[model samples]
Target: MGRMVPAKAAFAGLCSSLVGIGLARFAYTPLIPVLIGAAWFSPGQAAYLGAANLAGYLAGALLTQRIAARVPVRPVLRGMMLLVGVAFLACAIRLPFAWFFAWRFAAGFAGGVIMILAAPAVLASTPAALRGRVGGFIFTGVGLGVAASGTLVPLLLEAGIAATWCVLGALSLVLTALCWRSWPDAGVAPATRRAPPARSSLAARAVVLEYGLNAVGVVPHMVFLVDFVARGLGRGIEAGAGFWVLYGFAAIAGPMATGWVGDRAGFGTALRLGFVVQAAAVILPILTTGTLPLAVSCIVMGAFTPGIVPLVLGRLHEFAAGDPAQQRALWGAATASFALFQAAVAYGLSFLFAQTGGAYAPLFAVAAAALALALAVDVVARAIGARQVRTRRSVAA
Candidate 1:
């Protein structure tokens, strides 16, 4: 029973992570078009702000290694919650685009730190058997957050964009308070790195590639889907918002409901399945381009990518290398790579979307093709990684 207590605490921490990182932070993607319209920022300027946010995210992820070396995970996670709230409020106040960029940048860092930190605690604390399911529920917070933001922002926009900002900022604060109330207060792990050979081994590189492929496979859903539903479907803002709601809810369902299956079935297989589903879903928008197709595709996208995050993180435990401090630095680098891939795909699609006036079939087809490509690459990488791990074990024996 005493042993079960940390698991319970970790679950609470997971909730905090969802609110800070998943809900407050990730919701920005779906809100991207709307924010540009409201702030009168150029698409280029918006892109810059988005990049700035990713940069901060990179910094936070990198720093988690140092923080974890000194403190336990839960306290660090709790502190991040409050800081994330402040940063969200900073964005809500509508700073100059430059300052807003900085604040969003900071928010990204805090969010990355919070989510990354939560994983180690969950990993260390969760029973290996149950880890995947709990991971799914924890990850569900992202979809829930995305869905909440998607649904909340549009509803508030109906009242005015200012109202929308206030609502998001306020929700973050509430989450911060909830975090403080529920857990020990500390920042994330400290920064540290391991010295291996100057270059990474093939296995590390493979892990990075697999993560990057996952990012590419999901980019269209991240960047273009909202506009696709709005402009392509001839829906108003309400309908556009509803499309995100569907997407976010589906994302939540993917990780939350099916996470256990991934744990039992294996993340690699789960990932392949997710990629196939996403490929099929992206095709839906291409073929039908109707409200129903759009909604279904959103659900499919959510299932594939959302499950990928927790699964990858969970698998990190399999070949634990370096000090725990260095482990997070490794993971953060991988995350930065993931974010970089997403950014490139985002602006690329935006350019394409503009060229076509959101014709969408090309984009959806391209996205499906990307996911298939990723899925193929992952198959090769995972096979090699598995073989190498088995070889090392045989040598040790």
Candidate 2:
């Protein structure tokens, strides 16, 4: 029972993501078709709203870093979850584009706050040996969110978009209430204060660039995979929903499996494996047409999507030479950079789809290529680190 306590705390941290990310940020993907069907906005307008949320996320990521030491994370996390609930309810109001954008942006911002705070706090509270497992558990919330939204939104859409939005908001409120006391206190871990690495460090550059590219990798699945399955492939909405549910369940496995691998093989090696798997997953749908193939593609994509970040974060800390401060700074920078890249890609890919008359093949291809590039960058960074070590050894000798 005592052994189960930390895992329980991790589950409480999971609510931060279940509400902030699962409901607030990711629910939009499955709900997109309903929004268009209900004529709440045109497809193009919806694209902009998606971009707006990413923009808000970027702002929030940056702000979390700046206020890390000054602000208590638990209160901020609770407040952010509450704000996410409010934003979801606000979406139900028949508002003009500007107001809708504001609400979506607010939700995105709250998601960012939860992402930045929840897992780090959990890691701090947990013993070192359990850190990897706890992280895997916490991030599984992303998949849970994806699964919940995929399953629930379709049923709720029967009652119209407004009701769907309100029910989701209410669900978030209930979750927030249930997990209210689970998170660790503010001082549990170094949520904010980290030593900064030198600007010219090879590992620093590699991790930052890898973080940016990681955002690109997720864009295809997160933003367009559902539409691709349902509309592009003529699979229908039910098929799309099934794929999403598969993605969620598979994603739950991704972090747990990969976290164990990272513990055994090392974070850097695990991350490289993740990059290869994710890139292949992105390209699988493009290469095949059968139901089974597409379903496998969805599962592969889903598993890797939420799992990779914890690995990257682990790698960042590993390369930070045991400096807690540097680890924190790099984590913040990576988070902010990821948000910025995602925001840009959201708009750019949307524009590309519009220009090409909604052709999705090119988008997935681009995302796969971007992941390949990230992997290459990590390889070079590792090479640089090895060279630096050799030079230091020669001097000492």
Provide the TM-score for each candidate, comma-separated: 0.83, 0.91
Cα lDDT of model 1 overall?
Answer: 0.67
Q: Estimate every model's Cα lDDT from 0 to 1.
A: 0.67, 0.78
> What C-alpha root-mean-square deviation, in Å, does candidate 2 show against the real structure?
2.6
Tens digit of per-residue lDDT, candidate 2, span 153-238 = 77888898889889988988887887778776634343454555544378777878887897898888877877898899998977
RMSD of each: 3.9, 2.6
Tens digits of per-residue lDDT for model 1 on 199-227?
Answer: 22454555556676677767777766666
TM-score of model 1 relative to the true fold? 0.83
After superposition, which runs of candidate 1 have C-alpha atoms over 4 Å from their true positions?
A: 1-8, 29-47, 67-75, 158-163, 181-204, 290-292, 321-330, 355-358, 385-397
